[model samples]
Target: MTKRSTPSSPQSRGNAPRKSGGGWPIPTPGDVLCYAYLWAREAAQGQEEGLKDRPVVVVLAATDTGNGVRLTVAPITHSAPDGAEGAVEVPLAVKRDLGLDRERSWIVVSEVNGFLWPGPDVRPLADGSPFYGAIPDWLFLRMREGIGVHAGRGRVRVTKRTE
Candidate 1:
């Protein structure tokens, strides 16, 4: 399990609790999670975005560390940014399986982050929510490969088709 140091002064926004260990179910790889993200300000760009609650795809399986589970995830956005490199377009089948309402969405593989689950920062998608469901194993593997390639980790070569 990878260890991440806690920020000295963690930013808090919206109704998300500021501590770890909640009753929320620990999300596994392939699960789409919904949470409030306190995106850091880009001072040079003169921008301050706060409390964006949205769906993110769990790219790696959660590792329980007694206190809370650690998760690596990539953001799922309805709008695909123009010329944004390393954005993997989510297929219609996978989107339908995940119960996403958007006609199209992309997994931002380059924007992966390690977060503590059942913590103030991350939580499961609400019951009956459109963003609640798991992607198929093939899609999950493709996402993992996308992340690996984007991060300059060696590419994952898969030749088998699950169809």
Candidate 2:
């Protein structure tokens, strides 16, 4: 998790963002970005683009050489989880603050995707912000715990997004 300095550093990563230099919004943990997330199953089926664009949480982000950032993001979905996916419910209050819809959503920590920042699938808000907003610290920690638990059990499926 080597962090790099930026003008608009990420609160979660401590060294992320360069909003003024603008291109890709600096990635930070807990920041929810709208992206076309390619699932492992889809990748295995030879699919490249995500079936649909969805909100994904930046669970892990590390600066790569030359301004590029590598990220591991978990999908947020309205589907009710069965508990095996290490899904954590987004507190209604938190959702409201982020301006998300009233529909219940869960951060699916058991599954994640890896990609470079500003990848083709990553899309910004209409206002050009990198993310909608960040989830609370407590909630992030819970998601982290789920990631750890699933990783320990070898259940976390990481689908790599390639050019």
Candidate 3:
């Protein structure tokens, strides 16, 4: 996956106060992040394809590691829900608040992943100026609720949520 310039030194990335002795941006719950995910393809020899760069919402608060922060994120997809089992629809207002260009998108709660901040596979959104922002608190709470319900079904593994 291609890498963008590293997120502007932590202080300018978000409104959240910088961590003491800051190293990486401390992503808060509801923050939207850009990431490149590798999706597996149904092919011989377990071939896979990259999902390329996309926006993902930070569902869990970040943990500051001295080296970098780790975050749990849910990918935002433009696909129709069609009653998909674990898809959580992102409301228009929430999308607007997050500055997402797509009019309609779904947070694939079942596909959450842990990412290291400012890493090659993930970084803050910066096309010209920093566009990194957070979704509304209410929307984030609803998504977390959906994730909990989905998790309780025992379909998504605990390791996927924790690791």
Candidate 4:
């Protein structure tokens, strides 16, 4: 996957803050590809304005031997207009079972860190308590051969939403 340059140039002055938290590198293209499944859904639903400023988990899966499933989970920092950070994880046994010898193996987002923001810096507080929050217009609930995308908008507590 191609590496995305950090938004540090003077030209990026108007860009939203690079990050709200520290300790991680920006999202990679592969990370972005994992989320492509969501894009497909969002586009299909004809919704495009939502999804910014949220933590999202992208999950991908592939079939394995009988009675088992292959799964991967990734934690992604969703920035707006075009920036994100991500961390990918998979079970060692599953990896071997699925022959995941390359980085292109399946991955998914299990949780989100914060609410999806508008643009990049703004966070709208809920008018009521325990805001149910908004689901991205684009969410991949299913995958082809048990592989697809999902959007949680923040660090998902459960890495694998399902087996």
Candidate 2 lDDT for residue 92: 89
Candidate 4 or 2, higher TM-score: 2
Which residue pairs collide, candidate 3? none
Q: Which predicted model would earn the best TM-score?
A: 2
> Which digits, one per residue and each the tens of the lDDT, describe model 3 over residues 1-163?
2222233323456454664222444666776766665432221225332347788777775555664566677778888765666777887866665566657788776657664555556634455322356666666777788788778886543222211
**TM-score for each predicted model, relative to the true structure:** 0.63, 0.83, 0.69, 0.19
Q: Across residues 75-139, which tens digit of lDDT does each residue of candidate 1 receive?
A: 77776756455577888876665556747888766556565565455544444222365666666
lDDT of 2 by residue, 1-163 (tens): 3222322223433444353234545666877888999988898999989998888889888876865678899998899998655699998887786668999999988889998887888876676655767777778888999999999999999998885
TM-score of candidate 3 on Cα atoms, chains taken together = 0.69
- The candidates, ranked best first by TM-score, are 2, 3, 1, 4
lDDT of each: 0.55, 0.78, 0.60, 0.27
CA error at residue 71 for candidate 2, angstroms: 0.9
What is model 3's C-alpha RMSD?
Answer: 7.5
lDDT of 1: 0.55
Error of 3 at 15 (Å): 5.7
- How far is 123's C-alpha from truth in model 4 (Å)? 38
Per-residue CA lDDT of model 4 for 113-147, tens digit only, reads: 22221112222223211111112212222221123
